[model samples]
Target: MDTDYDVVVAGAGPVGLTLACELRLGGVSVLVVERLAEVDTTIKAGAINTPSAEAFYRRGLLPALAAVQEENLERISGFMAQRQGGRGGPVTMPPRFAGHFAGIPLKGRLLDASDPDFTGAGPAGDIGFIPQEPLERLLGGRAAELGAEVRRGVELTGFEADDEGVTVHAGGSAIRAGWLVGCDGGRSTVRKLGGFAFPGTDPSITGHQAMVEMEGAEALGKGWNRTPTGTYAHGPFPGRILTVEFDGPPADRDAPVTAGELQASLRHVSGTDVTVTAVHTATRFTDNARQAADYRSGRVLLAGDAAHVHSPFGGQGLNLGIGDAMNLGWKLAATVRGWAPEGLLDTYTAERHPIGAWVLEWTRAQVALMRPESHAQALREVVAEFSDTVAGTTFFAKKISGVWQRYDAMAAPGDHPLVGGSAPDLELADGSRLADHLHDGRALLLDLADAPAIRAAAEGYGDRVSVVTAAAPGRPELAGLLVRPDGFTAWAADTPAPTATDALGGALARWFGTRTALPTGPRAA
Candidate 1:
């Protein structure tokens, strides 16, 4: 088969765009095909969580993301101000926005903004509230800048994969590539065509979300409110309403969501006769959790909603999808470049599958606690007490926001603290931060001890692994650490002596591929 591209990504959403950018940065050509002619203006997920926000920050996508967030806040603030001006002279303070787990309000972030674990080594906080359209556009623009081709209005009708490569049929044409990834979303054609098994629980409830002009908006309580019928939440944006009905999914999911439907759903859930005059956009979702048995089926793979899907509770779906893109991008790039070790591509499933399972369980557990039964309310009361405590809040915050997410990696003997954990944002000697060095999308070897052996070992890989000799006095754990491109530490040694060089070499081979045992000069950055 004639291969026309290294990878043909189905879906121009955030996950596909992120994967395309990562592949392009790794020198792999990517073609992203989407069925939609324009960016989906419908608001899907509302916020980028801490971990996903940090991922965007590492790729230098945060500046534009932050700008969009600020602009949105301004727009919402102006709307609120206009509403308040005509009513009275002054009003009490509005409720502060915070993260939530299930429908339970967090009151405040679990992770502190100043915490290194939360902010990484970056200057920004762990969360951003940019709407989905701008976020998708930002990722799409970044992917194009990195030479990833995105063609809209071309849908992946079907695909065929064999030992050599995959042939994707989209827009009435065949495009061949070494790999094909479906980021097309929950009802993924690539996933179905690739024959990946997606198994999980069925939906117990239907969720309705809409942005509209409401006549009885003042009747509903501010922020999230739990009623005996169901739960409802309102946002800062005027007429943005969220409602959940315990009824199973709608009969016609593909049918256009109308203002009347939203109004009815809101009335049932909130027990208020809220009138929706106009609906800008509306959609329905369910808690039908399911994950592909394998992320890859021969040469065809899945990511984002294609790979796993759970309830949008805690806003974890978008973040999990972005995480999938980040984790698979470099590994797939390595495979395409012919430098990846055996089973390297398989590790994408091995590593991410468990996380997906955990997310499914997380949402499922939340659903159990959210039932309108008396037992569930009692359990929620106990959980609420726990959430008010520091330990409880911190645990839930890290879990929900993904700050405590860790992967299992081969640890060096006398294991370093940060191994297999999300690498911290180290403050380097030259007034720069550790995340600054990862912008080029390469494995990073930080030599805080100024170890010639470690630096020389890294030089063997050349540009594949960047060696930075910087002093991170505050972080003694940075003595010598090999950070993967996705910002996870593969190996670390506190001493960083010549004896430790052998271990570092092994980790480099394990992650960045085998290299000639040469004593080259140190690379300075």
Candidate 2:
């Protein structure tokens, strides 16, 4: 049979499914092709980060996934670090990883665990983990519900593309689309076929994730406890423990690491001859460092591991992949509907490439510190208590939690309101949050009673922009906020100052372009 879609996405993993879901919501014809019959059971154990959650929230996927998770895990699981001079304790915990950048304000009291008001919700904060399989299934179902064509058991056999569109050859059939995205993971055929090269630093970490059903896990622990700097317990599940270690490396592709290999590692590390009766799921991996030289190549783009792979220090894998989907989804939709500047598509790479590299370099440093040499071990322990450099515990939590992702995307300090993380939850006069309002598929305008400027700033957006003047109670200084279709804060104006005024137009043109045409309604028909 032959099917032609607006976009054909390969590898129905979390990233691909997310892209499909968001595109389908925008009324874009999308297809997802996966060779596997079902989602895999092996878990990429970690919480879904705030930035990632925001990305999903933008697509209306977060609430559903959040409902399924065991609340949100918002604590920083400390890691040990070994130094060259002498391994000491983990570096000193800095203030809630306010940020690596010097001048950023301290957002958390790293030392004060009792600060109930404190929160770890930023690009660099803890994620909500509900297992990748369930997440993928949910995303797939959601995408299908939104009209994405999911073809399972369909292998990607070939592809041919030009400026006009992309034609995907899969499962002994032909599928065409305006664009093709490869979320297919490492060794992506689309990347290779598109001649996109992955050039970057070191190899990625090869580790296995196993759910150990300890008879008395609660008796042992609950959260990520210190098992020394070299290793740590991610968390003791109900009679279970999710673990990832720095193994040497996986063998060749023809010989992927198996359950038995993980079993051996468990026996060696845990010692005392503890028996691993069952393997929930086991896999091997390596090479913690790699990013595509760029994210785009003609009509084919890479997302998830397809575009970048790095040490899993931040639990960034799936989250980063989903972010890619969120970042590209609206842009793709606008382009297809004839509302976006062509250059906007290229910005995906410009915006995310540095982020990929930053995460990689940061993870590399963490890995270097995890070395188990005698002196290194001692230093890691001491530093855990004292050091205040980038290697400190405070920084580690913020870094890996993904709070450290500072983007040049928004140039001026106070320029664009949405420069940082997803838009903050602003309480409306009616108690509804600014976040809740934009859940409908639409571009949001947060009007801080600045009608003339808000409208003047937003007028060029045409019918494409649904202007909502958010009159934030009490804080009238918050003149306005621009909410992107994906739910991230694009522009926030505090009191409508002149310095930041120019940035409003810049921010709009950056993502949607000055010429973007909003749908007649929030939901694209």
Candidate 3:
């Protein structure tokens, strides 16, 4: 069949770019299109969660991200010193890694490397202050390096999908592809054009944020302002301000936000007449939560904000979108390559939709806890108490950091502990690591026991599944394991299964499609 590309990704943001990179790694031809001529730096998601960070590391992009974060740290320090009188006497600032949930800090102590629960979550280099702009640059550059065509200044005007392929109309040009994925923004035209059902709750509060010269920035202090009316926060820098008004969202949600409107909102929320001298950029957002009822509609699929959107309270939007791209990339590539087993592509929605719903609920819970009412205040106080304890703080850290997330490997195989979870970064006898083995975007039959039987079981899949005989002497709990392309564990055994060949054969067929040729020896050691 003649097609312009294997997949046409509508949107060139972080999610879209990451998806294009993954598809290319899987040997799929992809085209990424964005309406804007350049990357958008106005909206800042300043950090990534552990899983997204680890994904970048596995693809050999972490060192660049670490360099960007180091630069950002120095810039933040300088900004703070300049804003705070430049007095070098122990210039105290908030801890760089202390994240917040519902306006309360999830202290860095809980995320310490010593914690076993947090072990193997991600590389240490990824847990820093990397911002979104540099991340996009890295991802876009990597996608191009892997041979994905990215076309900016081209808008996806419309699309039509049939059984064979999808015809996308964009920028007065028509392009046919085997599939189309909408990684566009919250108000995605592709989503609307595909007739996907979006259902969710409306906004109960409005958030205003801006960088401006203010007269009384000092009184606002270094942290949050939880007043009787609303909440506001002035950061380590004087010009950066955030205000939350519990008033319902504005009538015109699409109206352009002005500095005047933000100033007014700031005064109302903070209950202070802080004079604003100048404004750089201002934007308004809402607590409105929504999700597409289905991620797939025929040949059209959705990811990122196009599939689900919620309050950015916990900074979960970007992380969620990244997870979606990674999860869908290999399955979609397998389908395009004519090797995907039955029901493999469908698992993308089944596995991810519930995770999307959980994030929406998480944000909703935060909104409720942040309400400026007596009951909400009492609840917040209780949660604050919990945050002060090790168990409570660790629980919150696990949830926020995404270290404890696990997907269900429905009807897959052995009920090993790591099933449906990310494969731990295991150290091998050769001093190499597990993630280092997966750089090529192929499933792994990691034979930790150096079991010849396991190697024999993986013989026929060839490049689709790589068998690795790594002596993971530290992880005595795992004799062998099967990990999917996206790093989630598919099956595991404490010892070789009684019927090793039959069991491994079932797993290979279920995940990587039937084998094409005789087995090559262990792809890596």
Candidate 4:
């Protein structure tokens, strides 16, 4: 079937844009369509986790993220000074805000940065507090620079898929592509029309998160507070407030949130007569957790909130969607380029579905601990106590920071511990890091001990994999490693043994296809 592009991505949010950038790097033609004419200025997702930050670092986008974080920190400092009545010396932020669990603050000073999972991560080890707006803009700009075509004000109204390709109808016009990915968010039209089954628990709480101007704002306490009605948190930034009420979902989820409505919820949760004077921006969310039965169906696929959605409790939504983009982008591009191994595209679902399911459960656990009753409050106290200790703090930090995430499906029999895990950003002899070599979005085979055998094993796939021979003095125990395009370690070698070379060959063939000319057609059925 003739196609206008290799992949047509629906949505111009961070996830879709990231996927487009990855595909462009893989030399695939992609088009991204967004219903809105401009980027949404929503104050969503105040931070990104470690894995998401590392993904950006590998693509050389960390500098952009750092700039955004600096601006956000300045704004936060200003808000703190305002709260302090601008009296004492300039109030500074804590050295690290290691994130929180169910509103329980995990002090960054208590976290052990020397943990094994954090090794070689460098500056990307820490979580970044970049709002959703700037993150989307950054990804959009990168996608554009990579030559991914983006059409704003074009909505995916419907689509039809066949064994050959998919015809996507957007903005009253039909466009053809080899694959269609729905990054269009929770209410994704592609997901519904593609017949993906969404199954999960319903929501029981309506939460309000907003930035506003309020009268008698001082009446509300700072930080997280639990009352008889529900829970409320005030002033990480002045007028930046959040309240959760055990009142099911909103009556009209799409209705615009008003000052009077927010004021009533604040009064009920804060137990104060605080009045909302003006709402600069506001959004309502719920604990409605759900996941698609599969991420792909024939020529159609889903990513980000299109595949799974949970509460914004742990700030995991944006990070999770970014993960989806990184995982799927290369695989789908390989398929479109006809160099993908058998069932390569299918692994997108196999490796990511479990992670999505786990995220759903993680958010549900937080919601369970946040109930307004005495039992949940008692449980919250015990959990908070556990979270304050060294071991407990480390555990929560690992989970919240996303360092513990490993793909069990990517593992082989008797694989090294590093296998199926994120590759450490090993520094080379010339002082360049592993991420520096990965900017081209190709698989990497790093030969730490100058082993000709390891390099020989990667010979056939030179077009798809880059071989780097560098001395990693910090990790002398290793001889070589095979890292996928997404920075996951596919194989690791302790010595330049023949058996290690054989394993490297197997991993290469498994991921990059056979040692022959690149196929010009689809995989043989």
Candidate number with greatest TM-score: 4
**Each prediction's TM-score versus the true structure:** 0.94, 0.80, 0.94, 0.97
lDDT of 2 by residue, 211-277 (tens): 6443322233333333432343434233234344555665563454454565565444443234555
**Selected candidate, larger lDDT, 1 vs 3:** 3
For each candidate, the alpha-carbon lDDT, in order, equals 0.81, 0.63, 0.83, 0.89
In order of listing, the candidates' clash counts read: 1, 45, 1, 0
Would you list the rank order by TM-score, best first?
Answer: 4, 3, 1, 2
Clashes of 1: 1
lDDT (tens digit, per residue) of candidate 4 on 1-525? 689999999999999999999999999999999999999975688888889999999999988899999998888888788778788886768554376788788877787777786665777865478889999999999999999999999999999999999999999999999999999999999999999999999989999999999999888887778788888889677789999999788999899999988999999998898989999999999999999999999999999999998999888899999999999999999999998999999999999888889889989998888897889999999999999987788898788778888888888888778899999998888898999888999988898988889888877687888888888988999999999999999999899899989988889988999876532221110
Model 2 lDDT at residue 514: 60
For each candidate in turn, give its C-alpha RMSD to the true structure in angstroms. 2.6, 7.4, 2.2, 3.5
Clashing pairs in 4: none
User: Candidate 2: where is the Cα deviation over 4 Å?
Assistant: 1-3, 71-127, 201-206, 212-235, 238-247, 252-260, 386-394, 404-406, 412-421, 460-463, 496-510, 514-525
Best by lDDT: 4
